[model samples]
Target: MGDVWAAGDAYEDYVGRWSRRVAVPFLRWLDVPAGKRWVDVGCGTGALTSAVLAWKDPAQVIGVDTSEGFLARARAQVSDTRASFRTGDARSLPLPDRRFDAVVSGLALNFVPEPHLAVAEFGRVAAKGGTVAAYVWDYGEGMAMMRYFWDAATALDPAAAELDEDRRFPLCRPEPLHQLWADTGLDEIAVEPIEVATVFADFDDYWRPFLGGQGPAPGYATSLDKEHRHALRDLLSTRLPTAPDGSIALTARAWAVRGVAGRPA
Candidate 1:
């Protein structure tokens, strides 16, 4: 089954919350100067765009995404005069070349059909000496919340492995991330891990969002019959570590890559 991207609110509940957290350290890592132009490619819900506006005090932040639902939510939430949302593809951006001082994407690179083309576009739009960066979940290991869920899920139904993001996206890893930037002729390449704490008051706080059907795991979840779904849920409940306060605390890690842009490969 294909992933869902049109339900902005549902996505917000799923990964947008964590993406916002990732955006903070991500911008700090870029260390771009104030009043620079920025492009948030695959800028879903304006999380990174809002971060640019709030943190970098940019001259402008142009956010591009394919989903109108996400752009609408972004437009509504990020009313800052410096930020604007547009519908566009990552592989073929409508932006002019070498116009942005900082080009960044958050939790979005892996979702691109051809992420290398998207990276090339990122390099194309970024000004000489400008920074190009993006982040994606470490779904195979470090993303604890999803890690636990997937572990519990695959155990219950081996077929679920086909939809598992860990197996699906190899580029989310650090080595591949660095190679992609290097192949694009981006210099000063670096890949760092950004982790955020995801604490759920109870299993329900974590479980209900899976029912929203906004992403791969959630989409896979809602596809199951009632019995199979409940079986998966029960399996997760038994497996996840629960604190005495009844909270389920987990960490989500995303691999972030950055480089200086100018040359093309």
Candidate 2:
């Protein structure tokens, strides 16, 4: 199944909001020093880029994405003069090699058609001793938000299993990520989990984002007919736990990996 990432506002509504929660801690895990140049590959809506600007105090950040719509919104949201948004592919970034102190992507690597090539590109643009890091939702289980939805959808329609992110993105897990870094020749490789709370005001707060059709789950949702969509929604509502205030609280976990960009031998 193809991943949808065309609209910025729709993306922000779907998963970008939660992505922000993971950014600060992801950057903290890297612990890169301030005033260093950074490149945010697949920097959709500027979530990670904004986090670096606010928390890491980077000298400059270039946010790249294939979608011009995402870049436009990122440019609008990030008013900082030090930040710039561009349209570029992850496998072949449009920038000079060995120029950045750090290269990072949030919730993006798995969406790349050839993640290994993208990882190499990240390594290519990073200076020696610079950090290369990325994080992706653990769609197999830890990402409760989509997990619940997919579980319900698959139960209702076994065909939905084909579209599940868990089945589609095996690289999101820790072991595979470690192997990727190792294969890329990056040194000091490490992987960890980052989880955040996602509390929705009500079922609608949780359900409305699915209608945005900007990601895998949403794409699956919008693909269904009205009757099937309603059935899936009803099934999810029954499965999820709601509080006294009719709010739903779930945890979203992402697998994060980092490594030092080694100098060419």
Report backbone clashes per prediction: 0, 0
| lDDT for predicted candidate 2 compared with the true structure | 0.94
Question: Cα miss at 265, model 1 (Å)?
Answer: 17
After best superposition, candidate 2 residue 242: deviation in angstroms?
0.1
Report how far off residue 183 is in candidate 2 (Å).
Answer: 0.5
The global C-alpha lDDT for each of the candidates, from Candidate 1 onward, is: 0.91, 0.94
Error (Å) of candidate 2 at residue 178 is: 0.4
Clashing pairs in 1: none
- Kindly list the per-residue Cα lDDT of model 1 for residues 173-238, writing each as its tens digit: 999999999999999999999988998899898899899998899999999999999999999998
**How much is 152 displaced in model 1, in angstroms?**
1.1
TM-score of 2: 0.98
Model 1: runs farther than 4 Å from truth? 263-265
- Candidate 2 local lDDT, 4-49, one digit each (tens): 7889999998899999999989999999999999999999999999
Q: Give the C-alpha miss distance for residue 208 in model 2, angstroms.
A: 0.5
